[model samples]
Target: MKPIVRVVRTGTANLASVVASLRRVDAEPVLCADPALLRAADRVVLPGVGALGAAMGTLQGDLGDALRARVEAGRPTLAICLGLQLLLEGSDESPGVPALGLVPGRARRFDGDALRVPQLGWNRVEPDAGCRLLEPGYAYFAHSFYLPDAPEGWAVARTTHGVTYTSALERGPVLACQFHPELSGAWGLGLLARWLEA
Candidate 1:
């Protein structure tokens, strides 16, 4: 039987592409926002787009708590783009708002003085030695805020735009990506396939 992947309804995510990508990998993608279902899922994909505050607002209360508990328990989860940022403590984009805090640190804006903000388009992701799903390839990135460094004990993947930042971080069954894998072509699909198999 195909693995049932619960795609969280963040109210601000690119659900169409994400759902299509999961289906392409032969997994059953269920779009859900229920806290109970989220905690009980075999696999979960937390996808987000647009502003951080708005996404956080949608995730407040039981939904946010459920996601934190799921990741803390080391369940299989794939967080994409703003989803990755939501895993951190907070972001510069929205001050005084607490995030899931699954990973330490905050998301900061790319230095506009040094290079372009948002870092739109494809960029290289250099995976660390122990990465299971991420490979060295150009992934599609569309964000202004980024985690400056990798948290300890997480399998890190780095990418450079203005500065070298953690493009992806994996620990146990939880994987987070700063880029949108659903829109990232073959390399992204391969990563999704590996995650599904794992």
Candidate 2:
């Protein structure tokens, strides 16, 4: 199946990271920001990073409408990092920013003094046993905040970073991850290839 990979297009740095990740998965990523661009593909993949408030603001004001329509249509979709944060109603990290509310719960940092902000490097994200999004290995994560928990029927996979946090989610054909699959090396690329197969 063809996946219409989309980069949020907020900054060059974010776009570069996305480009690198998609190429690793061997998927066709489109540069267009318009919702109509999604019409050409069978699935959607959204990759993002940076501030959640700013990201949600753009999605709400612009891409939000388009994405909502696309995902609701049942075309498979996925999100990574800030892309995952944009899935909720809003984040406690940055108050007042409206989110997609696709999943329940708000986002927050490590919430502990011992743990570092922006937990970097490789981490193991275990699947819920019932979750279909994971294999047996872990995914890469680089972020300060995380989804505490997605409402029932939403959470598909999870990982520990300072604390156990939601790592992946699925609602219908929509699949999202709190980790950066592209940066996870073999595991990440393999995950993308699998998503395409699914």
Best by TM-score: 1
Taken over the whole model, the C-alpha lDDT of each candidate is 0.92, 0.72
**Each candidate's TM vs. the true structure?**
0.97, 0.88
What is candidate 1's lDDT per residue for 31-131, written digit by digit as tens? 99999999999999999899999999999999999999988899999999999999999999999888888899899988767698768999999999999
**Model 1 regions more than 4 Å off:** none
For model 1 the local lDDT of residue 160 reads 88
> What digit string (tens of lDDT, one per residue) describes model 2 on residues 71-157?
667667777787877877788778877788766788887878788777888888777766665765766778888887646876477
lDDT value, candidate 2, whole model: 0.72
Cα-based lDDT at residue 101, candidate 1 = 88
List the pairs of residues colliding in candidate 1: none
> What value of lDDT does candidate 1 attain over all alpha carbons?
0.92
Per-residue lDDT of 45 in model 1? 97
